[model samples]
Target: MGIRPLAKARTSFAATFGGLPSGFWWLWTAQLINRACGFVMPLLAFYITEELDRSAAFAGTVVAGIGVGSLVAGPFGGALGDRFGHKPTLVAALGATAASMIALAYARSPWALIVGAFVVGVTNNATRPAHNALIADVIPGKDQVRAYSLNFWAINVGYSIAMLSVGLVSFTGYTALFWLNGATTLIGAVMIATRVPGRARPAEPTEAEEAAGGFGAVLRDRSFVAFVGAQFLVLTILLQSESGLPIAMSLDGFSPSTFGQVAALNGIVIVAVQLPLTRLYKRFPESWVLAGSSATVGIGYSVLLLGDSAWIYGVSIVVWTLGEIGNTPTSFALVARISPDHLRGRYQGLYQVAWTGSAVVAPLVGGWVIHTWGAGPLWIGCLVVALAAAVAQLGIGTRLTRRVATKDPEEQPEPAKSAPASDAG
Candidate 1:
């Protein structure tokens, strides 16, 4: 019995993860390294309010600096990646991320810490546009969803490790948190520089293509823009898991260690179910999948109104994590499908802006709500925003279906190559 189940598990693993290109795996490995110690951002609120002895409002402002930086980086990073090369862009950005993290660790003064957070946001986010672009560049479109799903799983796995480590070690201090994060980010940079291939630049755009490309063209995409807006709404709710949720728990008398354990549960649930659900969700329409997932996230967070027990928070995290599992990879795949190859980076960058941009708004609003009113109103508001986002997503789904039905043969994206050229190590 045990032997048969073990064999079945092996087969499932192979079916789920097998056959990606070397470059994709290298990219996956690099991201795993970077995220494995990605504890700082999630816990930055605690560090500021508890360690620095700042107010919740002040922490929100500092955290908002990351959003400000991300908003700036998204479009520019994508444009640079499109104009130059993804490999070089990632190398420079990751190196900067490492330096900025170290700088953030040592910052003591209010102004210094605020500036450090902003710089950390810029360098940390600048890689995302190129990262997603490279995936679209290399992976066959049919495989991009699976690749992204696996990547999401890797992210949660890393988050689980990071959070659990924080629970274990954070009592010592958070200085090591920034240092470890920086070191891992630097290693990821080295991995990219040494192992990933420099993608061959595409043929220069023709007159029509030139007219349609760049940030102007991306902005002109009304459908994509609306989709981004819905994304922003949903992210405003989800990002609270990192920013507002921790502070809420702390105010309710939980320790940072307790918060870390609960936050780690979010990752643990994702690590367990994300891949399997990815396959399951693929069977449904993208729009309905997203709508349902958004609703699920809202319901999950709303559960917080019931109580403040560790068990209640754990349930909240798990329920929302299920929604997150369905939402992230499915949404990314949809974005990839809708985007033109020439504008993949910008599309991804704009997509990233939805999340980072929410970081800007969600924290400021959530902090104020928690400080001024209470956590109750904040959780209530999440449900309202999530329902609105779900409605918007359904409209997007209908439009996407119509767009596909009406698309001309010539309008279809050129088939991507099986794999990108890699630098021989």
Candidate 2:
């Protein structure tokens, strides 16, 4: 009976993951490698303060520059993908990211590091829209959620490994982290450039599609624009895990290794529950799921106001990580659903802007809050912002759901082999 149950679980897992294209798997593999080797960004605050003896405020500025780069990269790369091809955009971004990482590693002065960080941020984030667009292009709409969910799972698994390794590697010095990050990124780029099929141009948009595919059309999407705003607010809160949380721990006398341990909890929790939760979350409406996720994030961060220990931090991480797991793939899937086939790259680019823009905002504000009122106030602010975003998302999500149901009836998604018919997003 136990063996039967185990076999049934295996069958269920296979059913859930089966029927994705070879291209998506290749992209997935590359993303996993890129994320595992993505070690530099999270440690930047420490490197600036501990290694270079810089101020937290200065570190915030440098981090803000990363967001600025990402802000430009989102639309630019998406345009490139739409015009030239997703493969070329992805390859170019990855290769540029590798070079920038090396440049950033060698940079010693404040001005040099800031410039390098901006360049690195551009090259690194330029991959997002193109990568997402390609997935949408190749995968059927029905499977996109599952594909994204699996990809998100792979990302966290890699993140877990990377965060866990940060402690051991930091004792050696930050230089190695940059070098390994560059090497692996370059390898992933090469793999994609060689393995993935390259197209000189995407299929030409129809007359109507051409008219609808411009940035103006994307801007005219009132629901999408509002969604982006709500997303921006939620991201401002969630991204603090990367930007503010570590800085707070450091201010509290925590070492880099200690910070790494606590940070790793985010990825660890995601790794354990993302897929199972994906299955569960699909049973609920996206509006409720996303709104609830934001509220959950607010509640999680509020845990910090009650205590000041690593255990408390760990507990906070576990709660917020659950929100992150729910939000990330669902948000991506929603963006894909809202976009037209020909304008996918453009729509995805603007969506990327919301995230990158928030990355810019979160650190500056978080640093100020921490520096002025301390960590308690910062977390309190997160709670308030997150709850507000939740309310906004619920309303927006409900509207979008109605729009998606009525608007895209012509779309005939490919049939799955044995997968459940539920909308996984």
Q: For residue 285, what is the lDDT in candidate 2?
A: 63
Show model 2 residue runs off by greater than 4 Å: 43-64, 105-113, 166-179, 197-200, 247-258, 370-377, 407-425
The residue ranges of model 1 lying beyond 4 angstroms of the native Cα positions read 1-7, 39-64, 103-114, 167-180, 247-257, 305-309, 370-377, 401-425
**Location of the lowest summed lDDT over 10 successive residues in candidate 1:** 416-425
- Residue pairs in collision within model 2: none
Worst 10 residues of 2 by lDDT: 416-425
Query: Which residue pairs does candidate 1 place in steric collision?
Result: none
Q: Candidate 2 lDDT (Cα, whole model)?
A: 0.83
The residue-level lDDT of candidate 2 at 394 comes to 84
lDDT per prediction?
0.80, 0.83
Cand. 2 TM to true fold: 0.85
192-300 per-residue lDDT for model 1 (tens digits): 7887776755346778988878988989889889989998888889989877899899999999888977877877788778887876766556677788899889989
How do the residues 28-129 of candidate 2 rate in per-residue lDDT, one tens digit apiece?
A: 899999898788887888888888898999998888788778899988888888877888888888999999998887888889989999998888888999
